[model samples]
Target chain A: MADPGPDDALFVNEVRGGDQKAFEAFYRRHEAVVYRTALALVRDEMTAEEVVTDTFLRAHAARERLDPARSPVPWLQRIAVNLSLNHLRRRRLGIEALPEVAAWPDEAATVPEAAAERRETTAALARGIERLPAQMRAVVVLRFVHDASLAEIAETLECPVGTVKSRLHNALRLLRDDLRRDFETAQPGTQPLAAPDLGEMGESIG
Target chain B: MTGWPDLARFILGRRAGGDPADECAIHRPRLAELVDERALGGTQADDAATTAALDHLWACAECQHEIADLLLVVAGLQRLGGTVNRLEPPPGGWRRLSRRLAAPRPRGALRLRVAGLVVVPILAALLVAPALVRDLGTSAAGAVDAATRDAATVAVPVAVTHAAALQRAFDIGDGAQADPAAQAVEVVPRGPLPDGIEPDGSAFLPGVAVPPMPAVIPQ
Candidate 1:
């Protein structure tokens, strides 16, 4: 794991001392992560923006309580995750498509369009991820996007480690099936999709 | 698969190389659980049930298919993770936050200033109270002295008036220096006196004129 960023603890102390400059500096450093994480979960530009704003606001409100010895990123990410989840709950935007596959580019291109195809694959993957259940989507986002550990995700979601693993396992299966269907239908020449494998599972799967 | 970006490894944070778990009726309900354990290879790879499950799954085409599909899904998710553009705040978001921060904090210097505004006057009063009390004491003493002189001036006039009224009632002539004996003798009662009455006693009526004494006394 990367050593906790020095700025997180330092800026936390400065913000606790009522230093706005320090807080602004801190926000500038981490806002992209926070915002991207929210966008990954919510998939709505507006709500994701709200989540980002609320995350920072809450962080500032609780600045004094922050442990300056640790990285504040996880804490901030946790807040963003919670806010995004709550927003989803309030809107009652239940999972869109889980077992059901989302529509993908169903072309029959024979040529290998690497860059354009990758972008298309990435976009379809995002849409597929957004269709997952909120809780499952959170795990996927945290694990893949934020690179959080299982323990960190469990803490953030307030669930057991076993539950996190199960969710991530299920989430990976769902996205994999959806994206594969999209690829197979889109182009006959598309290759087996690759992914970040933290385990020996990747090579075996391929 | 080789040329394709290993998206699953990127998403799962590990390269897939372990044997896939075969389908178990008992583990079928908990396949994801079993698969997750296998996927998180490490000390977990040594677990008995996970090991047994994987050994069996390597021969199971259906379960292998599921694992392969899940890997692709994880890869898609990994790519999805990076798809989002870095977010900038809404227009003027930082400026708004700066404005809020610039406002005086409830518990900050503004609070101290307000406290000072209230306490400074009270402290000044406390500091000056003794001096004010001393000055008031001095002024009060002077006021008492002036009031005493005014009282004496009014009392002297009142006394002179009372003496004049007494002289008129007694028929004492002006410029006559009446002695106490003469004043006492002038008060003799002429009418029939009560049994125990005596002349020149304090019982005599002051304003009543006395008849001259008869040449012969009548019993």
Candidate 2:
């Protein structure tokens, strides 16, 4: 778990008192998680960096309101997620496709096959995740990347658990469809993975 | 969607005394919820829902397929988290962020200066230029002065625009900080970091089981 270190509260307290140096300390601690989380959703390196800056900026700007008793990571996560979604929405104005990292799996790991199989599932993520709608994508990232539960995802996205569940459900369904299509495309003559038009299994069907 | 309790109640009812043939129809709608519960390790209390879902899972190929798909999606997400865990944020992030932090806060002074400098000239031009135009009766000087006032009137908006922007920056500070509710709520512990899951976060999610295999596989 990311503790933000024991002095996190101290830094947050100092930050609330208008300490720039302390705010820097706070930003340094959380930047990686926030950046990677944003990257998982926004899929662009620079935009993910922008999201981190915005998250900390928002955190710093709102620093005086920071609760010294709480961990600031979730708050930071909330801001990063919001900024990522905003970037995604604004990027959609240009209707851009997701860029691939393509540099993954450079060295083979020596983990067990179960671990390896899990990696295979995630190997499909960067591609399949690109096809998800921004909201659903946010839910997916919060669940897996941030390791947040449905309720935590709801809080991060500021929606109800039901909405989280629904988005996650549809997001998974869409990802499954994309995966199936990809798997079928690889095969010689399979009838496109036979569970016809699971698109209707979207929330409308639920 | 048929919410958990309603669906669970129906499923439980069907399991108790309902027809066997209708299992798929009764259970299919809530398949997503069932999958989420299992994948997330049934965080919510079960109304014997997990048992009922599992019982249904072994008997139904379509349900098995759907559940398998959802679990794979969850596992994919879990793995995505692990993959991203290996990455570091670009170097000197704090340097760029510190630069952002050093940016000047929205002081009302710029707007004040804009109002004082621009508004004064604009008012002076508007008030004096008309007299010049009226008194001089189309003289070149008056015409020039009146044209200047027209330009000044158009220019007044620059201050107003800046004023609006500065106000928004202020609102971002005041309005967003109003509730202070975000961090106050406790994030439920994620349980434990599962295998293949790195403790990448400073204290991100430190909870729960590894992604599980689906109860039954579809042919």
Candidate 3:
């Protein structure tokens, strides 16, 4: 909640100077966001944790190349995203495997009700997001979770703004349709409906 | 009046601004009136041109509905964003990074230790091998010398036995004179026999006729 102070800046500067304390501070500051982003992409917590750790380790190794004047958050995010994507690619090739979770909602239920709701919502969103094609899911996660701007997303994805826009449009439409269908299904007495057809939406966009 | 869909597109495009002349010239003021009813509330001024375009929105319905739909979409998106939790880094994230950065680098010491482990023994082996070999060689030579001396001691008695057999075949006793009747005799004349000895006389016979000594001693 507090604004990052001179100490934070000093710490980052020290990290650039190869200071371990500063590097640890940076890791502690960004691990959750990195892990969450990785988890969203890889769909595995252990892999996500590895991605988070690797991201920080790389940042530490490359600190000398880092521009101290810029905030390290986005840079760190980029590293985590790339790592997560690489992990996915390797998984697809069968060189790596996804991790299994022992429990989920039950474990989350032990938290306070509000926290539980948030967790459930996050889990649902994550499932919906996973159903999307890879490129589209990446755009959605980067845009929504990281709150990255269109330009930032484009830069991260290494694509044009037009591509990012189209991906976002398609992804959001799919997500909306999926959420709607899921909502109807969960409600008792409501008949389960077919997934909303996005062909009309796509035609409208064009 | 402009058609509903075209009017709607024009209104949405105009509201977003960056509309070229071709796009803008077709806008009908009445369409704007229709669209305003739906999308007018959160039409924040996007740019100066967009603000100026609002004058058209004030009068067109089709344009109003179009803008309203766009606004609704935006609002929905914002709600969706709100529903999602704001992602924060894990606790102690930065602290962990700082600890890592502050920790001493171990690679240098490890490399040195490994090098010492690998190289020191090799150097010791190289320095110590020659001495070890020399010591081994000296021990081997001493053993050979001892064996040779033992062999010589053993051979002396065997050689005496062989000499005794040769003496018996010649029928020569330890203290015997040469036979007087032998055809040839070899006298080394090792310092004239004992005092007062004749050429043919034995120690027991002062005047004995031994065979005539050969003119030249047989070899």
Q: Which residue ranges in model 3 land beyond 4 Å of their true spot?
A: A1-9, A102-124, A180-206, B1-219
* Ranking according to TM-score, highest score first: 2, 1, 3
Best by TM-score: 2
The candidate maximizing lDDT is 2
Backbone collision count in every prediction? 31, 12, 44
Chain A TM-score by candidate, in order: 0.72, 0.77, 0.71
Model 2, span B93-151: residue lDDT tens: 88887887777754455445444653686466555543443442232522223443334
Q: Write down the worst ten-residue block by lDDT for model 1 chain A.
A: A102-111
lDDT of 1 by residue, B1-219 (tens): 243454454434323433233124433444456455443432343455555556555666566665655655555454454344323445655665566556655445544554565467656655554443333212342222333323332332322223322433343235434333322212122443333333333324446766655443211
Provide the global lDDT of candidate 3 against the true structure. 0.53
- Model 1 stretches with alpha carbons more than 4 Å out: A1-3, A93-124, A176-206, B1-60, B85-93, B100-219
TM for every model, in the order presented, reads: 0.51, 0.61, 0.45
**lDDT value, residue A7 of candidate 3:** 63
lDDT of 1 at B102: 62
| Candidate 2 wrong stretches, greater than 4 Å | A1-6, A95-123, A188-206, B1-21, B29-31, B43-49, B103-219
Better of 2 and 3 by TM-score: 2
Question: Per-residue CA lDDT of candidate 2, range A120-203, in tens?
Answer: 445565678877888888887777766777777776778898998888777877888887777666675663333323332232
Q: For model 1 chain B, where is the 10-residue window of minimal lDDT?
A: B180-189
